[model samples]
Target: MTTKLDGNCLALDTVSLSRRNKLILDRISCQLYPGEVLGILGANGAGKSTLLNVLSGELPADAGRVLLDGVVIHDMSVGELARRRTVLPQQAGLAFNLAVREVVAMGAYPFPELSARDVASAIKAALQCAEVAHLAERRYPELSGGEQQRVQFARVLVQALIARNPGEARYLLLDEPTASLDPRHQHGLLGAAAMLAKQEQLGVAVVLHDVNLAATYCNRIVLLAAGQLVAQGIPAEVLQSGYLRQTYQLDSQVIAHPQHPERPLVLFA
Candidate 1:
């Protein structure tokens, strides 16, 4: 059976990471609350993925802390962490061919004792949510890149849903989820994530390269430059041309979206 997760918060306090005395993240602090999608935006080498890793607890912060519902994440056991959050990297590879359904079912591995019926139900819900139900029986390797991405997303969703404690918020860290997807699938994937944040109250943080996509889908954005947070706020506040130019070093024009005036549309110069 699917567990109902309660809305909660994940917070980072002055998180920093370094390698060989070189800073990769510079005391960045942020919070992701339930019922919201937080986008991480930065140019290449700006530490977007590093921040995601820290938030996910895959990489330890050198000089700060990450808290889930006020509990320090670094102190949590592997199983405890798995029950609360899942990370979907840019690429998930499989050397051996597996059916889509089989691959998605892997997400439930954390619950090895679950009944077959329960596992099947969780996988089904995930596939439908990720818009990959039609490909469930297909071979994962045979599917197109976009199809594979959807399948992997379904896996991550299933993992989060099955492992979460009832009434406790879960988290998802997606690193460049739309990188390999076409325009339509890109929107579709992010749309599903947004729905989950609003409906299921999952705390979602996605690393994105597309400014327009982030503006349209994110509740708030954190802009990073050279490992430091430059600006963070609602899309309208942070998508200003000045910030974009400073971080991305690209001249761009920002205009109000004709349809959604509250959101900005970025046009490259």
Candidate 2:
């Protein structure tokens, strides 16, 4: 069961937002608890990315609040927020032609307390975790789309690792991180994220387009449709046929996975 909201999580309490006078996010409420991945799923234009932005404090809500450790996120200074959370947007725009290691090193900027040795160690660990160690010498602009995405993931992983305060809970907010990745790297990326959550006790909130991927990796899933939260719960409880149809406008049979019986596998008609 989902834990009750307390002073230990990043959460949205009846958050809402509007863009260009059109409602982009309705009263969506959810939490990213430490040590678990929270997956956001929906059809295109369903406000999946917008919800992630709100959680990351990139976009302010029109009517409610985002809290981190039960404190208003808006009240935290930019550096204070960076010390505890790292966000990987849908696309990272870098105009420079820096090498891969240089890009990952950017994550260290938020924590000035990290020494040179500490920064180097954090970069190495992040590259290995994101599976981009071999691309360390490659030019950032020269890598393929998938490779670039993994590099960006490495960058954010660096931010998550070398926080100024090690005891405080950290968060990784990803928006469609695997969209450019192939099947192998897609699973690899999500698997790495899940492992980090388990090992580091980091809270991970990822926006994903694939239902099976969400069921496989996320501890909990949040479904959004047209700016409204359709459902949020454990995968077995929320990835039901009715919710799937209501959110995606599709028919599907929900079944236990052959290899992992606890996870739901959706077979769309």
Candidate 3:
């Protein structure tokens, strides 16, 4: 009964959500398309994560709807949804001792019939993409926070790649993907995501607190304030100083990136 849709677009139509008589999202709407990275930006408690949850179909909207390639998201089965998208949460916890390779291989669970060689190949490719190939044999719990985050990213990458349908678009939903990473890894991860969007045509939506990173990597930015979408457009248009000041309530300077003049750089005043 499920039909695959043409083109690649994840759209939210006037979506709204409330919890405990409190509005968590107010008639929010947006679209994420293939071949582009969309950055979701907001201050603390600005509903960035909540919006991600809604888009990923983990949380239902009280009004409006979410569509993945024109099909209602809730209409798809969990297995079908997993095959179309992968989510990397802010925190990845592991209570048991597991090897990094083992963690990465977990991403291939959806492809049960894949040959061992295929699974190994996918795991290796994902680890290399995430820059964690050197830690393959190490215990995951023994790695540093940044290392673990990279491993988790690799896992999701493998999941996305393997779950992808031929000629169909896939999505990656990441929540604060760079929170524990060092400056180098932060850019590296986002760079990888950008490459995936451009090269593989994956639709990537990431929640980021760093303004400069979003401006540099994402083709479009969505700024939220108090659970409502305040701005959504290219970084130059949405990352204006006035809009940022009003939303974040912080005095800041918005300048053009010296190297990429078209992109804006945000600096605290």
Candidate 4:
């Protein structure tokens, strides 16, 4: 990744983290640019989520810095950060049985300036983007796991859209968002993420366990192993057989997707 300073990029500058005497992340450095999807790929316990939490300012980097648009993220106020970025965790808990629209409406809390009509419009647009418009009135708790995940996607989309600042780009951080979805919905969710990066000029960083999904949707890929950055580059540069074997400890074949030659397809043994 390029280290050139840009006011439009979210970056990690040799960031490291530790917990209970264990190093969870070790000097990971990368940049997420506006209008691009950067994918984080790793096996279990590779510290993908820890890296994301640090980027989102949910957890501080013990050694280095996490920057948003040339400003240190930790120095920014919570409201300021919330207005510019939204995170969707691996699992989100809702204590009450809120309707889908109500859950999405919670994203508007950061912007008290929005009128009721404006919030409603934002929610509707988010629902349509997430393909959950028909579920707007449905009870969130009663929906299937996949449906609930899509609803959460809508909520974050609303958060990203309504709080956007002019002359600045927003960001979306998603952790394992496709873990609960079927094959089709997995593509839908990631497709929407890619669309957001391209059409809305939002910087997106997503943690994905599935390498193929990352390759299909991401503009760049970061491979992590044992809390360190194994490789960071375009998918074709990083998803080779050697890197896959080192990261996953498996033999695999990497090939170009016939339909989309720029995208690599992995066949694991």
Candidate 5:
């Protein structure tokens, strides 16, 4: 599978950030390969979401650099960044009442400016991929929490792939992507992302709460606790009970899964 990214590439170089004198990240450095899934795992305030924001270009790094491939991400204008990256924040907002199709169409607003024909086709594709095409005309605010989240996913997918190219790399950042999803759809979307990364060769990073889900879908998992890298590597190496207890302050157990070998169950300790 192709793993090369467009322009230089995406990387974090000793990046640090703070808010109101509170340090959120402490010189964290990491790289993501093409067709690789990187899971940022941490507790509620462990800086998982902040790291995602820094990588996604939504928030600036306070004392370090973020490079896209080889180009410093800070150098790119917002429009330029839009051409290469997509981030699905914890809650994508909706001020104006809009239909699902209209919401999905907003993703295309950044590129090539999808025409009426293009919007219709692209929205259809995104909805189908997100399994919400049947609810295309439904109002966004009126949908169930899970359905709205799916619709948001549709929008995010549309934005990321509207003008995709094999020559140019694309990065997808999701914050707790399955937070509102039911068990089944949660599995579906995470499964879909893994396939997209390993099979279709997309670079993906997501903040996840469920250790089993991350182990199953991600190629590598990075753990943070109080703004430090406590663990990172293949699932087996990084998912020990001691690590879980220390990082999340929770009693949990890990065991191999019957269906997915790489992913394991996070049993109650």
Candidate 6:
């Protein structure tokens, strides 16, 4: 079961955002509680990635703010934010030549200096978490697409969970995290994220085009259409057949999963 709390939350406050002279997000506002997995759902060009950028502090909000426990997201220093949140953007490219172990250990780069032992421990932990421990010694660019994705995810998992002191806020934002992976790897990545959210109570937000996976794993769903929030609530509420049909302009049916009621099965109309 997920814990519900009003405090220790992350929120976007009336944020009006755009990119490259094009307006994308318009007056958006929402709150994410600890241990809650908020999955962002939308069709192509629905401003999902833009919203993630705004929340991740990658791009500045034009009219509002991002808050961590009522503190602005950008107000905190980069190192401080790095210690608190981790974002995994799908299809990340590495222009530089770095070994897999070196890439994974970079997650702990928020601190100035690390003992050799700490670096080794952190890389090992990240590799294990990402299920790429065997690839630790490989060259990052030589890895397969799926392997590289897992490696990047390992980096994210490491940084996000490295500092586990009590009362510290944490976040993981993924844009199409499972798009390139096969079915097995998709489950593996999502399973790892779900474990982090449920066991560690991390605040995770993922932008997923796969509605079924979003319903199956996320604690809450946020639906966007043409850069606007049309729905925000539990999977059952936000993934309603009517909402799906209206938002996506397609016919669909919603049914409960036999194993987990929180998981919704979508069928075409």
lDDT, residue 243, model 4: 91
Ordering by TM-score = 4, 2, 3, 1, 6, 5
- Model 2 alpha-carbon drift over 4 Å, by segment: 1-4, 164-166
Cα RMSD to the true fold for all candidates: 4.4, 1.5, 3.2, 1.2, 2.9, 2.7
lDDT of 2 by residue, 128-199 (tens): 989999999999999998999999999999999785355579999999999899999999999999999988
Number of the top lDDT candidate:
2
| Tens digit per residue, CA lDDT, model 5, 60-166 | 99888888978888889999898778888886767668898888888887776557787678778889989998999888888888898888888888877776776
Between candidates 2 and 5, the TM-score winner: 2
> Where's the lowest-lDDT run of ten residues in candidate 6?
1-10
Clashing pairs in 1: 6-167, 6-168
What C-alpha lDDT do the candidate models reach, one value each?
0.90, 0.92, 0.91, 0.91, 0.82, 0.83
Question: How well is each residue in 1-269 modelled by candidate 4, as lDDT tens digits?
Answer: 23764578889999989999999999998988889999999999999999999999989899988889899998899998999989999878777889999998988988999899999999999999888999999999898889899999999999888846666788899999999999999999999999989988899999998999999999999999989888989999999999988888899999999999988999999
Query: Which portions of model 5 show Cα errors greater than 4 Å?
Result: 1-8, 113-115
Among residues 3 or more apart in sequence or in different chains, the pairs in candidate 2 whose N, CA or C atoms overlap within 3 Å are: none
Candidate 6, overall lDDT?
0.83
Q: If ranked by lDDT, best first, what sequence of candidates would result?
A: 2, 4, 3, 1, 6, 5
Model 6 C-alpha lDDT per residue in residues 135-249, reported as the tens digit of each score? 9889998988899999999888878877567767688888898988888888888888888887776899999988888887888999988778888898988888888876798
Error of 1 at 149 (Å): 0.9
Number of the candidate with higher lDDT, 5 or 6? 6
Number of the candidate with higher lDDT, 4 or 5: 4
- The CA lDDT at 5 in model 3 is 40
What digit string (tens of lDDT, one per residue) describes model 1 on residues 23-78? Answer: 99999988888789999999999999999999999899999888888888888999
Task: Tell me the lDDT of candidate 4.
Answer: 0.91
Q: After superposition, how far is residue 88 of candidate 2 from its true place, in Å?
A: 0.4
lDDT at residue 203 of model 6 (Cα atoms) = 90
TM-score of each: 0.94, 0.96, 0.96, 0.97, 0.92, 0.92
